[model samples]
Target: MAHSPLDPASSLPTGPAPRVSVIVCYLNGANFIEEAIGSVLAQDCSDWELVLVNDGSSDESPAIAARHAANDPRIRTLSHPDGRNHGVAAARKLGVDAARGRHIVFLDHDDVLRPWALSRMTGILEREADVAMVFARTLYWAWDMTIGKEEMESSFAPFPPGRLAGQVMLRDLIRWDTRHPPPCSIALRRDVLLATRGDGALWHGMYEETALLMKILARHDVWLLDEVVSSYRMHPDSMCIKAEAAGTLSNETVSRDRVRYIGWAARHVAMDWRSRLLALTVWLKGEAKLRLAPRR
Candidate 1:
């Protein structure tokens, strides 16, 4: 279905452009879209616009998003013009293209951003001119629980409020770190995102954030915010779970993704032979573990 011809934000008097553009992507996510939009609407920071990309879902997601846009000027619903299921990367790229904010943050339809998430993350980017991305901690919310049952706390990154890390360290961490920020818990500069948005085909249409993060790290410093600013719901219906169910989460797929990441890193950033070798070894070990681990 086509979006409304009339602009949703036109009714409200125009003001200065928003400081943050929140891009949420979803396909057949009617079950959790409302809660996700509610989290964004409930943000303590008011200077933001919600760009909801429906991704041509064959469910109620587009309708729900349209209804939300009708009520709130800050929310805009969009979809692929062809009305087909392009992957998350393409959907996100479309949202980014339509965004009009200085900073950008991505929210998964099944996830949530805490009240202070926008204010806290954007403030860091503003204060630190050198920092290209600001990522925070996330709470792992079990499907049955109202609140997060466990904190996906970081033990490897530099501590407390925040810490800045350079390209070399960030690259190493991605290849080897035990705990790192997921896309849901991070905000990035719009220019950088646009410049590095490679085709969405990496990893055979998986791990889009991994490619984006590597691109960001190649040229910019990353800030690790120790505060928890989002909740990542762990449910069987998640994309990862579905992939696992389809037997696509095997070592072969993981290795292919790792190879793609290494090649991308080599092109963008010059890492020494040792670092590259270390990264490959780490991937091998992880794949080995996955092979040995019992199925759920």
Candidate 2:
């Protein structure tokens, strides 16, 4: 499943390296829109496009997007015509469709990425001959502006034959176990995205990025960046932190998704028993926490 780099500029309207589409999908993130856009603008690397998709906002979001668009030619906004297409998933789909760059960056509007996030990520993508996506370590920026340590750092293991994830799936097993999920640290190739036709339904709501990651793993290798190339804002307004506080996704859903995920991995993916069992164990632990959280 190793793909030759497709000219790095073979996308619909743009090429690689210099041109980038840093997509920031949002609902009602008017409060943080400027900060988010500014993060991308502050990048040391120039020649990037900003695709901002507004998913039916009731507040000042549209105005905010317009204000930025009016000033910057590289920035553009698309409003969700149908109400059904207004969630995170739909907004993401729209963002991907609107992207013209060969390299696609997925960023949350409420989250602030680091100055070198795109530069470093795209650099690795160019260097790594077999990588499908490049993921960097992110720093935790508290409300007090205190940057905490990196959450989950990868081994940065080189790709095994036929892309490590794809082979695991080909063997009928799951190859990934997420101790935690970080949204801002991921950057992907446009062809890898075009392969999926920019379907955000996989990443529609809660575990959207998780689903997207799985799809990418199907055909390519995810190269982990040891450097903290992005910064994630921690606060009460964040949807994920709120979900954790309310115990909405809680644990049961996670446990079930794990079973389903591994099943999907083992059934459709090509992997063996050992990998399946390991994935199962991880899911079971998550289930235990889910079942206990309510009582606690």
Candidate 3:
């Protein structure tokens, strides 16, 4: 039996709050959960806690998480009531609510953080009070768990390393005019995340991170680092890969999601006129893609 969110007796971390909380939420990711957790364990920074949220994984993953928790006081596990299969957004919300940290970092079960990731990111956040979040480049790993030399060389951010205004980042993200960091490479202030998330209603579907990023970048400053901080595992089991294999991933589906996100952002995120125009432009482009896509 899995622990319920309503259960007051559910074991969670207590005592002085750690400086950072690393949240890894998953559903049936037994194959890579250990490596993911290992990366966190390998972090040079020790002022952090790990929250593993099992979103109704019907595999050995829950047990694996339990074993890790047993070995380390900094780790704990969570799940929905009766082990319900909530989506990633809800699972992440559960972890965030239970997290006891000033800063938050999200790592997917299939990804791994570099050893100095936490140390470097936390140092930036501590030194820059105005930066609501910080992110570094991510290395996209091949299926064999190795990065190609060319991929490694190209992992650096194209933009200059420095602080960027929230609206500027949001506009670029909406227009798809610039590269954005993956979730694994980001560390944000918990309060800013909480405020941007606001009930997590807009994040239930695909492109969940995009929805969250639009809001955050619209309302807060972000620090961009020109270094790689994590590795994103690209394998057959990844959501997009599986979807693509099944023929369910298409331009139409992407366009629909993009439109939904744009609408949500227009309603939720406070943005200037230029940002709004860029969002409208992106929306039009998505509509065009959907219209031009050849019928299967």
Clashes of each: 0, 11, 0
Off by over 4 Å in 1: 1-14, 144-161, 198-204, 246-274, 280-296
What residue runs in model 3 are displaced by over 4 Å at the alpha carbon?
1-8, 144-157, 199-201, 246-256
Answer with 1 or 3, whichever has the higher lDDT.
3
Worst 10 residues of 3 by lDDT: 147-156
Superposed model 2: Cα runs more than 4 Å off:
1-18, 83-85, 144-181, 197-204, 248-274, 284-296
Can you give the TM-score per candidate against the true fold?
Answer: 0.81, 0.74, 0.88
Pairs clashing within candidate 1: none
Q: Relative to the true structure, how large is the alpha-carbon lDDT of every model?
A: 0.73, 0.64, 0.80
Best by lDDT: 3
Ranking the candidates on TM-score from highest down gives 3, 1, 2
Estimate, for each residue in 232-258, the C-alpha lDDT of model 2 and write its tens digit: 777766765555566553343453444
lDDT of 3 by residue, 102-198 (tens): 9999999999999999989988999999899997888877765431212442233355788988898887777662257778999999999898777
* Sequence-dependent TM-score of model 1: 0.81
Tell me, by TM-score, which candidate is best: 3
lDDT for each residue of candidate 1 in 178-251, tens digit (9 for 90 to 100): 24566778899887777666523343265557656765675677887878898888777776556556665533
> In model 1, which range of ten residues has the least summed lDDT?
3-12
Q: Please give the ranking of all candidate structures by lDDT, highest first, separated by commas.
A: 3, 1, 2
Model 3 — TM-score against the truth? 0.88
Clashes of 3: 0
